[model samples]
Target: METQLGNGPAGIRGDLSATDLAKALRQGWRDFAARPQYGLFFASFYVAVGIGLYYLFMVRGETRWLIAAVAGFPLFAPFAAVGLYEVSRRLEQGLPMGWTHVLGALRGRGDEQLLLMGGIIFVGFSFWVIIAHMIFAIFASAAGLGEGMAFLTSQMGLTMLAVGGAIGAIIAFIFYAMTVMSLPMLVDRDVDFITAIITSFKALSANFAVLLLWAVMIAVALFAAILPYFLGLLVVLPVLGHATWHLYRRTVG
Candidate 1:
């Protein structure tokens, strides 16, 4: 027999079964609205820490922006896991969320999963950085040549600009395909890392348009969140985070 929705291994088993996209979307919002305080608490913590770091960096000028970006990963690592744990706790217990419950979920497998996910994140990030630098180097070298095909192309830099954009788009798609469902799948199941990644890629490929929509939405949310030193994330983060869980449910559960 097919498993009952929430009782299944990994909080999901088969393909997307729900047909009401609008209803599913509404449910995601409603689930988050039902407990706004918990959402605010989780997001506030992120904002506070993020702001504190930003202030320190601005005032001290001790680290360049690039160095700050690299150095800050470990500090924000716990919040990343906290976000996942919040989703898992709600999935497993159906309990009304609280800050304490969020923290509790972060214990045990929470940390392990975070570490594993972090490793995956680091590898992907490094790959993107390398590719980006290579792109920059190629364009910079071309621009340095004084007069010739190099100068002609450099004068109408649109070609290089188009190439850069194409490269970025391809990389973004790959990144999304690899990670779209992997974390939730990991939280919901005992699947090995390789399987989770493969499944995530499959989900991304299968639902390319919808996943791209989701990806764009996330980017917008993040931009708004950080625009005001993360205060906006107090609303955007939980809504998007919870909705993401629901999206995973629809696509893979």
Candidate 2:
């Protein structure tokens, strides 16, 4: 019998190459340039959120919220990319590129599967924040270090950072494997969330090296984008979001 996941048919998996990364980036740039308004419009949401978070944490002195937001920020990227995916999809299909069309795609036909996937992302982010808090408590107490930036200047703080970084990497890779293509697949097809996630894992397994490289590139780009008060995300996020759609196209038949 043919493989099936949930109520939807399985997706066909394809091979990927390092070169595809460059190609996807080029196409993503083209798409962004072709529709600068949409790219900026979608990206502005992320910028607004970033600035809002900064205002809450720094200006208003909400350190707890800051910790949670920083820990969970990565989880927001895939969801934010949904609009860019729609934009690319429309561009690829030669469909109308109006705000109504692009924004309406966000409704996603009331698809529960996309919501399911989003729930998973949120859960993963919540888990990470909890883990981060625990790690902070354990290390900070042990080292007699106080909370906030003071910890970073001490040995215990450095150790905590190291341990947290290692753990965060593992979690991030697992999430990346699960959703790298699943989001686009979810938007592009009628597949169940589970199937889309499984297909994403299989694609990562089959093309581990290239996909890992792609993941690393994404991480590095995001880190750099975040350094400048998250303003850089205005450009970086949309490009990466559009590139991801092309990458999904190349990886899934």
Candidate 3:
């Protein structure tokens, strides 16, 4: 069993050796694969969501409706939190990582995790909305109030789009860092939400470069996996999600 200590608000501070981290990550994948059902469940959920969205975009082709559908992405975070918690629980409890464990986590903390996930989704999505509004206001001001952004074009237009993407990326990074370890930590410890968030940030700050590498790897893998029939996500999503559980364990404690 993994050792649990009495480290309060103070979290794991020192850096982990790259070799050790790598080993943990590899082991995580092994354990994850050993329990294929967990991966399948995650993958199936992701594929269903992706297929639904693609159907909306490709078949329906309604931009407004698509945008509305996009709004639901935030809602997924709550349900995902349960999976994240389950992965951690299995790891900490020395239980066989399987479908039973995943379902058990959902059954046990379904309500609480959903509530926490809902809170996280609201705050994160609200931040996105605010930032988007700011971008809109800035664009509107430059193009003259009440007038559309017809003037934004060519190099300048692309630049604005790039800037917007950068802003979104930054938001993503912040949220990823904030929640990466926090969710699993919450499952493993009797800690409050605020502390979990704070500790997550600290872990991210401590391991920014490596975490960034992990994020890039995940993004690239996911992008490639989804390229051929979004159904591919059925395999990719679970691997990455389970891999993430391992990454957090290795990188943090």
Candidate 4:
């Protein structure tokens, strides 16, 4: 029988290797295939959210909204995977799938752990959005607040991209460390958000190199999948969501 991860300071196996990533990917694909309907249903939320944000950004023509739209989906992805985690968990337990059961799992054992974790995600994203606007403001002032392709191609504009991208990457990685296992652990166990966060940090710190590679894989795949207006999420989101649940299983005990 699989060991249940403890509520406090959950033990991390800490020996995850490259092979485990591959195996998890395979299992994730199998899970998606076994229940494509659920995958599609869950992934559709991401697609719709992505498109709506993009539309609002394009329509309003504001730097902050544009930054939010571009960065929101990628950074907020872990939270969106809750349902997929539920799906993968059910498949693992050979339990029947249903919309209500999976959706209720987002409430997370009725202890509000999921809600806390979600707040962290939202605050982190909001901070990034603010920082992103500040970065743009500096560059925009340099360009005399001119609005055109000219500034975008200028050296100052390029520097803004580099700086903003670097800071955003750091913030994203921090959230990744926080949520990579916490979300699945929350869905699978009845722990508080603090324990889940610390356990997640322990798991990442213990296997830094391998897990960093896993983060890179997620970033690259998500970038590619999101490029085509999030259509690829219908496949990529579920696969990664399940793959993450599998990874969580191996890391946290």
Candidate 5:
């Protein structure tokens, strides 16, 4: 089945389906494979962050904080892909993919739209962290636990997971709906962040099922990639990042 072709608020978007997703994945792989260096360059940043998190978890012993921080990666990951988006965009448009051009993804067309979108994501993520900490405090105090994650396997831990995860997922999904299209759109076009966000919402509304599937795929892949000390992100993040750009191109223009 397909989302019926129609006019979107942004005058982009069309029929979206499983086939479109597969094609976008293929395109994403193609883009990354063709220019693995750029993908590697951008993904390295995540690898570094992940390594830093691992250090904090093992050395600094910030287990609870690490848990919350790890959960917040998805919120931050999309913006990191802006550079990947630039790479994918350049490849799609047949433009020169040089360091100066690709590295300047933040400056995107001399407009601040990308940065504005980033600010929205940052603020949302910060609030999410605060809520996560509060939830942790409540759960930890009631359970009488310390910084260690020993309670994670207990009944109270399970309950806290359920409550915190549900709340975290809702907040994450709201931001996902906002950024899924807008970030790429901001990179490809010079539109304001608000317009891009509205268009992103409309795109998600029109292709709810397919987009949801993609989101699940990304989340699963990211979590899996984290298992190997974040080294796996070198491959997963770039491939997924490029795939996201192609997905945006197909569904959101």
Candidate 6:
């Protein structure tokens, strides 16, 4: 059965244009420039964690951990974005920015709505990890593949990658539809997480074409950013994070 939309602080969803994507990027760049300190500060956390994960998996030769990290990291990205939402909110409202305010936004009024959203992200990530492991086991076992670099070169490994990538894309789209506006909505209003998610989904359905393009742009940009040992995320994460706020603003009215 289809679930009904929640009675939250709903708004009319605006039609998104390709030009709006460009405008959002420009505005996001402006926000980052106006407050590079906050952008850099928040970005540093993501870079540090990413680098730490790299060192653990690459340097320490913990490939299993790397698999889990790679599978799960994107799920947590929306939560990390709360900081950027706060920055954009402050910028839009002409509110004063500071360490106290930015950090306090992370506290989120001790709101359980954020916690509920977080739990959903966690569960989604956990499910992906399990599925990834299963795919690996099944394909590798069938092809008599061994661990380390050998599996990567084997036919089984290629098949696993193809299948996993397809599944991961589906999962990513689901999460994106649920979160593309929900997090910012939660931060900007008093709505519950369920309502925010439903609203986000509605917005996506209303403008699936343009929003899908935006999603593709985000994925490509992020992939390019991470290729540089995660250092690029110091900039890419902030820009995209802020842009996401602008996107949410335009989409949700």
Model 5 spans with C-alpha error above 4 angstroms: 1-4, 7-10
Across 2-81, the per-residue lDDT of candidate 6 in tens digits comes to: 32232223464546689989999999999999998888988888888888888877987756457666655666777888
Q: Which candidate do you rate higher for TM-score, 2 or 5? A: 5
Error of 2 at 96 (Å): 1.1
TM-score, every prediction:
0.64, 0.91, 0.71, 0.93, 0.93, 0.91
In model 3, the runs with Cα more than 4 Å from the true position are 1-9, 17-21, 63-81, 84-88, 96-100, 107-114, 126-161
**Clashing residue pairs in candidate 5, if any?**
none
lDDT, candidate 2, 1-253, per-residue tens: 4443322235444456778899999999999999988889888888888878888778875554566566558677887888889999999999888898788766665778877777888899889988887887788789775677777678888888788888888998899999999999888988788888888888787778889999999988887887788888888989999999999987776
- CA lDDT of every candidate: 0.58, 0.82, 0.58, 0.85, 0.84, 0.82
Query: Between 1 and 2, whose TM-score is larger?
Result: 2
After superposition, the stretches of candidate 2 with alpha carbons farther than 4 Å from their true spots are: 1-14, 60-68
Better of 4 and 5 by TM-score: 5
Among the numbered candidates, top TM-score falls to 5
lDDT of 4 by residue, 67-143 (tens): 64576557788998998899999999999889888888888898888999999899998888888888888787877
Candidate 2 vs. true structure, TM-score: 0.91
Candidate 1 has what TM-score? 0.64
Model 3: lDDT of residue 167 = 74
Cα deviation of 38, candidate 2, in Å = 1.6
Give candidate 4 regions above 4 Å deviation.
1-10
lDDT for model 1 = 0.58
Best-to-worst ranking by lDDT: 4, 5, 2, 6, 3, 1
